[model samples]
Target: MEGLTAQAAIVEAPGGEFTLAAVTIDPPGPEQVRVAIHACGVCHTDMVMRDGGLPIPFPVVLGHEGAGVVEAVGSAVEGIAPGDHVLLSFHSCGRCTACGDHQPGYCDEFVPRNFLGARTVGEGDIRRDGSAVGGNIFGQSAFATSALAHADNVVPIDPALPLALLAPLGCGIQTGAGTVMETLRLQPGQSIAVFGGGAVGLAAVMAARILGASRIAVLDLHPARLDLARDLGATETADAIERLSGPFDHIVDTTGVPALVERAIDLLAPRGTLALVGAYPPGGAISIDPAAVMSVGRRVVGVVEGGIDPRRFIPRLIDHYRAGELPLEKLVRTYRFAEIERAFAASSEGSVVKPVLVMPAVS
Candidate 1:
C-alpha cells in the first residue's frame, strides 16, 4: 500500500508556536485504525494548546473534534471496518478505575498518557524516526490526513449526515449537553443559568431546553452571541453577568475566569449545582464564599468533555441536529482546509462560532 502524506496542525511544545505540516502515515497495525479526516473542528482547545493550557507535547497533532471515514483497520479490531464513518473523541484508558466507573475523564493515568502526544498504547500504534510518535493525545489526534486512533476512540457514525458539521459533537457540543444530561442530570421543570453563550455555553442552553428546563437564562459579554442564544432557545438573555441575581436550580459556567465562576455560583439556588467546564490556567483557583456555600448547600462540579463517552453521546447529538432541535449547523462557519490560518484567527476574534476545516477532495 502506498503511504499517504498526513498534514497535522501541531504545536511543538506547551506555550510554543504552531503550524500545519505534512507527515507520512504508516499502515495500521493490530488494534489500530487509520481514518482519513474529512473535517476537524477548530475548537477553543486548539487555541488553549497554542496558549499552553493543555500540555500536549510539541510536534504532535492537536485536533480532537474530528469526523471522517475509516480508510484502514487494524488486524485485531472488531465490528467496525474500513469505510465506516466515524468521529473521534478525547482518549482514556478503558481499564482505569475512572473508565470502569463510566467516568473516563477522570482516568488516573489519562492526563500524562493522553497529553504527552505519543502513541498511548505500548503496542505498535505510531512510528517516527523508527520511534513511535507519542500519539494517543486524547486517544484520537484527528487533525491529520489520517489519524491513527484506538478502536475504542474511533466511533462509527451514520453516513447519512454531513461529516463536517458533526465534528464538534465530540467535544464542545457534548460538553454542554453532557453537563446537563450526565453530570448534573437536572430534572424536568428545573431552572438553569448558562454563562458564556459561545459554542459550549450555547450547547448547555440547548441541552437545558431539551431537558425541559422552565427558565433558562444565558449571560455573555457579547450581545451578538446572546442574541443567538435567544434564537436558539434561551428564555432570557443578558449581556452583563451583574444584571441578574438568581437562585438557579443549575448553573453552568463555561468560562474559566475565577471571578465568573464565583459569580456563577452566587446565582445558584439552594442546593444548586454549579458545573464548571472551562479550562483554567495552571495554579489558578477561585475563591467562593464558604459561609454561603455551607448555608445554601451549594455544590460545584467540574465537567470534562461534558462527562461522556463519545461513542454513546455523538449519535444522540446527531439525531438532535438532524431534527433541528439542536441545530448546531446554524452555529458553524465552514472554512476550506487551506484557510485554516484564517479560521483560527476568526475563532480568536469571537466573530465566528464554530469554525470547521473542510478538507479538499483527494482527486
Candidate 2:
C-alpha cells in the first residue's frame, strides 16, 4: 500500500470548516504502521486543535480516538500484522521515565508527541497538493480513510468486537474510567462526585459503579446528559450551579470550569482527593482555598489519559463493556466520515454524547 491516496478531514485554518478531500499518505516509517481506519471518535480535543487552542499549523487532520485494521506494518514493527484490528491512542516515547514506569500519559514529550503537527521524531506523512499538512495530530490523525501511526500508539484489539463501537475506548472512555479506577482507586462504599456529565464524567460514573462505590453523583447543565449519567450508574444527578455539601472521598471535575473546580474542592472530605481531568483553554486557572486544603489534608491532582496504560486498560474497558457493566454504547452517536461538520455541530450543541465517524467502507 505504498504511495496510497486517502481522504481526510482537513482544517485549513483556525475556526475553518472541515473539508473532506483527497490527500497523499506516505509509507510508514520504521516502527510505524499504516492503518485503514474503520471509525474515529470526534472529541472536544479535535475542536481545540481546530480552533488553535494547542496552536498546531493549519491544514491538519485531527482525530485521536481511532479504531481500525492494520494494512501495512513498517519493517521494524513486530507482533502487529497487516490484518490485525487495532485502536489508536496518544503517542509516547517509550524510553521516558513515565513510560518506563507504566505511565505513558505523563511522558516528558506529551505535547510535542501528540499536540504538535509533525511526527514526534521524523517528518510527517500527510501532503496536500504537494505540500505538508499536519498528519500526526495525536499520532494517528485518523480523521481519514487511513493513517500512518507509530507502533507505540497502536493497541491491537480483538477482531471480533465492532471496531466502530470500540473506537472511543482509546481516549474519552479510557480517561474517565482510568481516572476512577487507576488514578483515584475509589474503593467500595466510597463516595464520588463527577462534574460535567459528559463522556468523561459518565465514564467515571460507570467506573465508580464497577468499583462498587456507594455514592456516585453526576452534575451537568444538560438534563438529558444527567439522566444518561444516572442510567449509566450515577446514584444522583444535580445541576451545575447546585453545590452540595459533601464529605465525598473523591470529586472529579471534568467541566474544566474554574468555578466548578473550586466547588469540587470545597466539597471534598478530609483526606479526600480532587481529580482534575478536564481540558481548559490555555491560561485558564482555578483558585482553591489553601487553608482548607491544609486543614483537611485534601489532595488535588491533575490527571492525563486516566493515568493508565492503554494496552492494559483498554482491554479491561472492553471486558466491562462485554459484561454490560460499562454500557459505553449509551454514550455513542455515529455519523458518516463525510458528515464530520454535522457531527461537530451535534457535539457543540450537546445533541450527541460521543460522536463516532464511520469511514467509507473499504472494499
Candidate 3:
C-alpha cells in the first residue's frame, strides 16, 4: 500500500489552521501497521500541540485518540492483521525499564517517539508534493483518513464496539479513569474530589462512582459541565474548589492549573494520594510547602496515560462501557471530519466534553 493517497488535516505552522489536503502515506515498516481511521477524538493536548505549547515541530498531524480498522500490517507484526478493529495510543519503547515493569506510559523514549511528529528527527512517513510532512505524532498522526502506527501503540479491540464512541478511550478517558483505578487505586467507601469538570475530570468522577466512592465532588467553572459531572455520578459539584469542603481520601487534578494543584494538596486526607494527569505548560511550576505535605503524609504523583498500559486498561474501560457503568454517550459529541476546526472550537469553549471527528467512509 505504498504511495496511498489519503485526506489529512495538517497544521503547517504554530497556531495555524488545520487545512485538509491530499497526502501520500508510505508503506508500513517492519514494526509498523497502517490504520484506516474511523474516528479520532479532539483533546486539549491536540490544542496544546497546535498552539506550540509543546516542542513538536510545525507542519505536523496531531491526533492521539484514534480508533480505526487495520488496513495493512508489516512483516514483523503479530497478533494484529488487516481487517481488525483497533485503538491508537501513545508510542512507547517496549525494551525500556518502565515497559518491563508494566508501565509503558513512563517509557524512557516517550518524548521522541510520541511527540517528535516524525519517525525520526527529520523524516516523516507522509508526504505532500514530495516533501516530508510530519506524520508520526503519538506514533499514529491519525488526524487523517488513514495513519501508520507502531505495532506497540495499536491495540486490537472487539469489532462490535462503535469506533466513534470508543475513540477517546485511547487517551483522555483512559487518563482519567486509569488515574483513579490504577494510580490512586481508590477504594470503595472512600471520598474523592476531582478538579476541573472536563472530559478527564468527569471520567474520574464516573470511575470513582464505579468504585463505590462515598462522596465524589467535582469542581469546575462551567455550570453546564458541573451539571454533567453530577449526572455522571458526582455527589457534589461546585464552580470553585473553595466551595467544597474536603479532607478527601483521594483527589485528581485534571485542570493542570498550578493553583488548583496547590489547593488540591491541602484537601487530601492523611496518607491520601493526589494524582496529576493534566499537562502543565512547559517550565510550569507550582509552589508548595514541604511541611504541609509531609505532616499529613499526603502524596503527589504525576501520571501519564493513567500510568497504565493501553493494551490492558483500554479493554477494561470497554467492558465498563458495555456494562452501562461508563456512560460515554453523555460526554461525546460527533462532528464530520471536515468539521475539524469546529470540533476544536467546541472543545475549547467547553461546549463539548469530548468532540469526536468521524472520517468519511471509503467508497
Which pairs of residues have clashing backbones in candidate 2?
none
Which lDDT tens digits does candidate 2 get at residues 311-345?
A: 88998999998999977678898999989999999
Each model's lDDT: 0.79, 0.89, 0.90
Write model 1 residue lDDT over 179-298, tens digit each, in one string. Answer: 988999989999998888778989988998988998999988887888899888899988778876687999888877788887776788999999988878789978888987889799
Predicted structure 3: lDDT: 0.90
User: Distance (Å) between predicted and true CA of 157, model 3?
Assistant: 1.4
Residue 21 of model 3 has an lDDT of: 96
**Pairwise TM-score winner, candidates 1 and 3:** 3
TM-score, candidate number 1: 0.94
RMSD of 2: 1.2
Candidate 2 lands at a TM-score of: 0.98
Per-model TM-score on C-alpha atoms: 0.94, 0.98, 0.98
Write candidate 3's Cα lDDT for 259-334 as tens digits: 8888787788999888888888768888888998999798999999898999899989999999999999999999
Output the number of the lDDT-best candidate. Answer: 3
Steric collisions counted per model: 10, 0, 0
Tell me the lDDT of model 2 at 221.
89
Each prediction's Cα RMSD? 2.1, 1.2, 1.4
